[model samples]
Target: MTADRARGALAVLQDADGKFLCEVPCGYIVEPTASAYHIRRERARAQRRRRAMLRRRVALTVALLTVAALLAALMPWSGSGAADKPKDTTAGTLEEVHQPTAVLLPSSGTVAGYVPNAAEVEALAKLIYGEAGIVPSTTEQAAVVWCVLNRVDDPRFPDTVLEVIEAPYQFSGYDPEYPVKEEFAILAADVLTRYRAERDGEENVGRVLPAEYCFFTGDGRRNHFTTEWKSTDCFGWTLESQYTD
Candidate 1:
């Protein structure tokens, strides 16, 4: 074999048919057959193809994960802000809106359930003031007003506010000509307005006293509202239990 000096020290020697015979790298000889050379070349090509396929799979997985993260960020379960606001179901509309517990009354005199006349407001306010005005708690005063309202709503008691207040020893504190406090009057108006709004389904105004709590008595310190009769000296009694007896 003649050494080709033009090539580098690491050179490949081939036969007359142009097939690889051996490689001489820094005087180290490695003799390989033509079939082995072809087999190694094919193995290198296969390795390149496998690397390309693995890179493609990694890129596809990353893209899928990014899309999933974006979808999760847009969901309402992530927070309690605008995305979590309840949909307004009023009048068959599905629009999302801010729902308040108690909405302010409109400027119009008439509301959905009942109109607020001067006499009804004044009579209810007088009863509230006389019964709970002596105490400092506005909650107590509102409870008194709610008690009267509960009676008005109950079928066993008078339907109208004035009738319920004047129903023969039901509310001893109520007098037609008694001076009513201004705060009590305003409170009465607010309660009535909320009641009207609730009837129209405009707001979710919860009652201070449940509908069953229709009896109450006071000893000049605090008013005790109950769902049942307490004693014969109590001012109010449940008409449901009385009729059942």
Candidate 2:
């Protein structure tokens, strides 16, 4: 289109389908110069890096949420930490601690008495675990708890769960230095809750005993004890201790 056309010829290349491939003798074409190609390659690489960064952020978010969910599950039902003792829960009526299910026992029998001091339930649960091994069925542990309560009720035994449990050589395995498990504490809370409620004239459907019957041991061979009945009263077979007689 100019008088300088003779100096530089313009060319247009097309594919077999007649679609324009590119223009030649121009500064750029289908096969770009090395400098143009390097710029385009660097831009593509930056885009890939951005995409990878986004994927990492998504994965990190998902992991954080999973950890949060697990922590929530392990937290106490009353929303207190383990470092916070159940003994600290001395305010008014003790809140019920919900667990997955009731502490199952092998038998339901006569266990009654005035519940220990409202503040002593946590200690009572620790005492029960101390006497009963860690693996006893919920029913077995309940029997142990009831025995302590019976002692509290009996004019013959100590007036408190703490005193009864602390009595020399009774629990045999008790060591205050050992840690109390949260599970047993929870079960203890349940037992204490029922006992306190029933004693205060509240109807408790989850009550473990029909009445207050006392005495219990791994074997009936305790030397200085008396058996009230020739037959067992629901907790397999128990022999009452008669230290005075």
Candidate 3:
């Protein structure tokens, strides 16, 4: 068979319309099978693959973001907080510590006769805060309280601690309105206890200041740096806890 004859040849077909038909037998009942259909299918497959890749990228991004959020929540931000003042450090339990106060100076000799009560302790503590400004473990504060107690025993001053504190012009810083400070409160209480013990005949209870040497003043110095009196300066002021009187 020649190539041109084969292309031009046609097969005969019979129809059911009661007539003979003559036509080609090649299948072409509907659309033609061409390159366009294959192109469209390839484009659709490419779109589906792109969509799947986009979904994977979105899921990975979401997981990474979730992990970052969790890490942020779990991390502790140290070295970022409020600034505060140094808190006071007292040596004992609160009951032993935060208890109440005592004071006075007199023209004549005096000594404490009575045990200090809570109210007396409170008054004396305020007086010490007013005069001494409440330093930590400073005997200058105790000296201030001792001066007041020495007057408590003095017949020249009032008989009681409150009376001695309230006496006129004795303690220049004495503020009946002074705010109660914890340091002075404990100091006053401790001083009162020691004074009471010394009077009760207890020896060496750490009552360093002698009862006779009781008087603290901003003008006076401990051990009398310029004079024969005993003095010191814990409060940046000359404190003559021991004086001629």
Candidate 4:
């Protein structure tokens, strides 16, 4: 061979363009060029960017999941139909006295069911505040409410709460001008809530009196509830058996 052929034979590590040819373990010879190096560097940069973007997406997803979990933990959970039921705020009052377990009775007569409204609640609160005394027990307040509800339930009396209270000589404490007390308002709301729920067939509703014992007579200090009139009655008005449920 000539001098150039001998030099070419000796240059086994280089290609025809004088680029170095590297022998890989898989038996392939690779000639790395500047253009190829630039392309590989760009591809590596793109892979790093893709990996960073994936990590950011994963972090964002985890953060969202954590926030959702916290929100769920903070939210109040209730049973079916209990969400709409009025919650009682008489924990302090109940702690003062042992609250009697409510007597559940199937509602009867003309005014069996009721949906407590603002006007009716306000009226009942005023009457309860007046009749239940200045510092009456929770039971006494509830008793007065039940008495009014009982009269409404009886066919002989008016079917509505306002009518029953305004039924001339029926409720002596009832006055439209009376500024309702907060405690009485709370008690009235509680009793009416239970009454509404009981009318809707909800169980475990608390009540101070049964459907039969309607009449009540208070002597400032305390009130007395009975099925029939006592001989030593405060209000000398004699009611017949037809007046009761």
Per-model tally of clashing residue pairs: 0, 4, 13, 0
lDDT by residue (tens digit), candidate 4, 152-218: 7877667988887766545656666665555666667667877776777875576667766667655
lDDT of each: 0.59, 0.48, 0.52, 0.57
Tens-digit lDDT string for candidate 3 (162-208):
88777654455565655555555655666777677677787665554
Off by over 4 Å in 2: 1-122, 219-234, 237-245
Per-residue C-alpha lDDT of model 1 across residues 5-124, encoded as one tens digit per residue: 235786676754666556567465444345666777799999999999999999999999998777655531210123222222222121211221122233443365565666777777
Model 2 compared with the native: what TM-score? 0.40
Cα RMSD, model 2: 17.5
**Where in model 3 is the C-alpha error above 4 Å?**
1-116, 134-137, 219-245
Please rank every candidate by lDDT, starting with the best. Answer: 1, 4, 3, 2
> Model 3 residue 85 lDDT?
17
Judged by whole-model lDDT over C-alpha atoms, candidate 2 comes out at 0.48
Q: Residue 125 deviation, candidate 4, in Å?
A: 0.9
State the lDDT of candidate 2 residue by residue for 50-168, as single tens digits: 99999999999999999877865653121012332223122222223322223332123224543334335555555544455442256555655666676678786688778876665
Residue runs of model 1 more than 4 Å from their true location after superposition: 1-115, 231-245
In model 3, the Cα lDDT at residue 110 comes to: 26
